[model samples]
Target: MQGSSIAVDKIATELWAAEVIPRVKDAVVYLDDHMAEALHWNRGLAWLLDSGALAVRELSYFESGLSKAEEKAVFIVGEPLVGPCLSRIAAVVRASCFTCCTVITSCPPAAHHSALYGAVPQQELRDSFLHVEEQLLDWMGNMNFSTTVIYAPLALVSVAPNFVIMPQFQDVFPTLPAPQNTNDSCNKELGALPRHLQTSIQSLVGNLCSIMNMLNVKPDVFSLGQTSHFIGEELERCSRSSRKERGLTLVLVDRTMDMAGALTSACDSVMDRVVRVLPPFTKGHSIDVQVDMSSLCAASRSTAESGISNSVAPGCLSHRDSEIAMHHLVTAKQKECLMELNRLLVEWGSRNGLRLDVGGRLTPQLLQKRVNQFRGTSRNVLQGGLLQQVLGVARALSHPGAAKLQDQYGAEKLLLQNAVANGGSPVVQLLRSRHSMGLSLEDVIVLLTLLYSLVGEKALGDDECLLKAEIVQAVYQAAEKDELPLFLHDLLRENVHEENAVLAAVDHMFDVLPGLGSTADTPKHRLLLECSNSGTQPAVYKPLTQQLLHEILQDDPTLQLVHHAGGLTDRIKSGFGFFRAAAKPHPRDNPVIMLFIVGGVTASEAKLAFDVVSSNKINKQVIVGGTALAKPQEQLRLLFQRQFR
Candidate 1:
């Protein structure tokens, strides 16, 4: 060990804590190649793995591949999936894009994330390598993971290097001239200092690390509260049976390992707004309308990504309306953020690359709190909490694209109908190319994968993953069996409700009709009525008739449901929601609100709103509407926004 050359310092400070997973070889079925509605990101793992690009073990612990059953059962409507693993995968890929070592001799994050797409990062142009601690904590989520994940930054302290060093008692070694050296170059200085002097040198480096920790890393994680502990606890429980006591073989490599992955593409604030509740699986006729419950709320910018518009089907109208405005907000916010990032990148992108700096306190009285947490508590924990909330919105957007925007812009195209065509980023603008993509949203798909596969199945694989996955599937599958019964399919295909039989059956949002078969819209309407009846049912978090607005109205507390057609939440319920900014000079300037109620709304009314939600007197007119007030299923889209854009 003495004669061995060591390069521990830098590696320990930089490598991603995740295991290097083998990239599954995939013959990509481009998201655009297929109708966006026909796709499910959960099946992506199967496609990638089946193609043989990625080997399970070789992938980063965070970079997981999906299983067969998980993929097969995902389409079961009421059993929608949801979790942290997917978010962590997202975080890992994002964090790896920045590289520090231009040389590929050793694996590091910048290099690793770059490797995902087969790209080489010359140097992770740093904007300030802040939040290293937060990212590490995210990778540490509970719910079963063997290997208490290690990082290259930590490994760098121990990994052997090409340079050689001499025995401490005899003589000191000299610094070798390396092409990528950022440290001060020392020319062969071999002075034999006393043991005390050597100890002092060690202390100086150690102290530097301590200072860095104080400045950049977070303090104890307990500050994040019980949920953090809950995740860790879940991980431990899930990992027990999976841990093979036998020593495992592995090597440290980060996303930069896949320079090919990032080549393609890829928050929350103002919490306490949205709310939705449901039975575990898609069970009975019971959806609780929380008279008043505080839930998380954040807006999504509408430039792109979200699949909301008039082209949507009646069933999906509510889904589209509920999301458009919020996503529109996120787009605006991120664009501003992008500008700031671009400005900073010009300055800091070269050194270490910028990390989204958050958390940490500045002075005395401000102790026990981070500046941004608002409450002044730990920011890392809240960030994780935000990830959980974002997961909800993502689960809400994945669609089959049945209501895709058509090529028709007749005398009455809805004002919000062509929303997806709008661009939020230079990259997205190029990707969208066309005006609108009538497809299921990416956010909901990713969310479902995480919820159902990773967290729901507790997919750490360190324990009895086989058993746990089977159990999860069994519970949800039983629900699916009940809903998609053969008789139900026969009824659906018989054109019982709409002109198109299959569409007619789909319109019947319920599994079993509540006595109103040919007369009622079918099971879909029955299911809508069941929303009020979904007691302590396991299907609550599961999929809904329309994955769109059901989750929002049911899950989001801020979601207001009024009997009337038009008005703002603030104007109606003082301080009701966030829209009370300032009065507009003119009524036309009022924001158009797009609201949606799930299966509760009648199919005819849904079709009407789907047709009208996007129409305008002229280009860029704002119209706000969701489920019809007269519709039996009552979660109508209220005038949440003062006026639509």
Candidate 2:
């Protein structure tokens, strides 16, 4: 894991030095806040900007500070879809300044082209591209500065650039690549797909090649899926000669092919607990919790005889402290930890003549004072601001409303498991009593969709069918009322007709490795039991891809290195057979394995790849990269929008 971090940092730094630093001089940098935060760009940017390479006047967020500087500037845009906005911002900034401006995006030119004209009909794609090009040229001409556009197509966290976390484009265009237009009689069928998808695929392939070049990885074998055969061919064309000694294998898979793993809710994991209680995991690992300092001060005053000091102000806690608190809150086994901390706070406040309530606000001073008071104890519960934050999160999670929602989530999970294992009646009765479950209508729909994905139409009984219909009707009514979008109706309909390939894969995975789906109390049930048992809180979830890779690489003998020209679907068939191969000795002591997920990857999955390689579990160094990092909800929402809109 440490090695992975080092590698990622090295790559990000090298890329920054090579592309960004040399071009930036006495320029105001407009940073895309979202991308910066997601990719942990601060570290690299800070090192470069602070190192005196570029005389950066000021750093500004993309939305703000565009017109603040009347000087040459560098605009780091997030993606090509935001080209218009970026152009507008640059135009506004240029109006006030006569200096040249350079626009650098984390996406390729193809992404921008795709955004502008990819959706047009194949025949009209050229005209649309030309129109967009003309508009961009006109816009640039009006600006006072000479504008240059550079495509970085690099979205990686400074801490793990080797993982190469890409954006989840498939979520937006769920039915993309338009299947294989099999109507051979029609000439148009040959080029039925929108130009954008093709360009995007090419850009992705290009990005992969760049990464390979950066890493100096020459694989002896390429195991690509049908959708990604082009990547293999490109790699083959680029390779000078194969080095079998390295024994590197590249595995590329489509997200749709593994929907069950991507969409299924994690059971009994730290991620599950955190997601159930806290806000959704969007782009980053941190979450903000609004802490009421005034209330806490008031509570402290009431509890302690010595009036609490007015030095502590009311505001949100530090992000670092809050992150620490959240980590402990999610991993904590004893709920009483929060109560104990709360009790300690009140006790200390009372001793200091400060009045406090049971659910009072927590401040740094209060925490420090408590820590000082408990210094004599062997285990300092109030060691850091973490205790205070943990108590805050606990209070929120323990709320009646939050507790009820958690129960509903658990119930939903059970329903999914039961449906998949026993083919039981759909939980219509439970869903109908919505008031009792305290679940939102959207939650119900999501759960039902999950079940639909697993069971398929043929497996669902009459009662289950009726339940599904009722849920659909409710969803439709919500859509009519604008609580839900009209597209959801189409999404639900399409979900019902989805092929059972994902389901079959899920069954096969569980059959081969029961521990994966095991709910047993054994250590095998949890992926990172070693970390947990060692009293170290894991930074991220054990990635599903890592788990799958570990299982496949451990003592698998039948699998031999082979170069195949098939797509993801074909590769999956062969891959599983290879996984099922008996354990055999390898030629090399340590081999190189390359794993790529086509649609997108989660941060947790990326971390797991690093961990596995660092642990030397398979006695091999693994290089993992993906198309993007996307949340499950985002993926589902994208699918819905694609189907309906």
Give me the candidate number with maximum TM-score: 2
How many residue pairs of model 2 clash at the backbone?
30
Overlapping backbone residue pairs in candidate 1 total 150
Which candidate leads the pack in lDDT? 2
**After TM-score superposition, what is the CA distance of residue 414 in candidate 2 from its true location, in Å?**
3.1
lDDT of 1 by residue, 1-645 (tens): 222212222232222112111211221111111111111111222333454432222212343224322111000010000122224333433333221111001223332333233332333334212233344334434223211121211111110111010101011111112223233233212112222223222222222233223223211111011112221222222222332322111011111111111111111110101112111111121211111001111223223333222232111111211232222222223234223323332233232332433333322112111212222223333333222223232222212211121211110011111111221112122113222432122221122222221112221123333423432332233234443333233443333333354333322322111111122222222211212322332222111212223322233443222211112442455445444565422211212212212112222222222233223222221111111112111111111000011
Off by over 4 Å in 1: 1-581, 584-593, 599-606, 613-645
Estimated TM-score for each candidate: 0.17, 0.60
RMSD of 1: 29.8
Clash totals for all models, in order? 150, 30
Per residue, candidate 2 scores C-alpha lDDT tens digits across 1-645 of 234222433564466667777766656666554444433333434554664433332223233223535456666655563455556554545344425666666655544555665542222122323333334445446534466666664554322334444442333232323223333232222124445455555455545555556655554434323344544554544443433333345666544433444444442222233333444223333322333332333234323322122454322222332243333333333344344445645664565554644333544334434433433333233333444453344434444545565575576556655554455645566557765666655665555544444444312445644754565555545544656433343344444323353233223222222211221112332222223322233212243466546644664444322354334644575657665554332323235566777666544455556665556554565666665444455555544453232
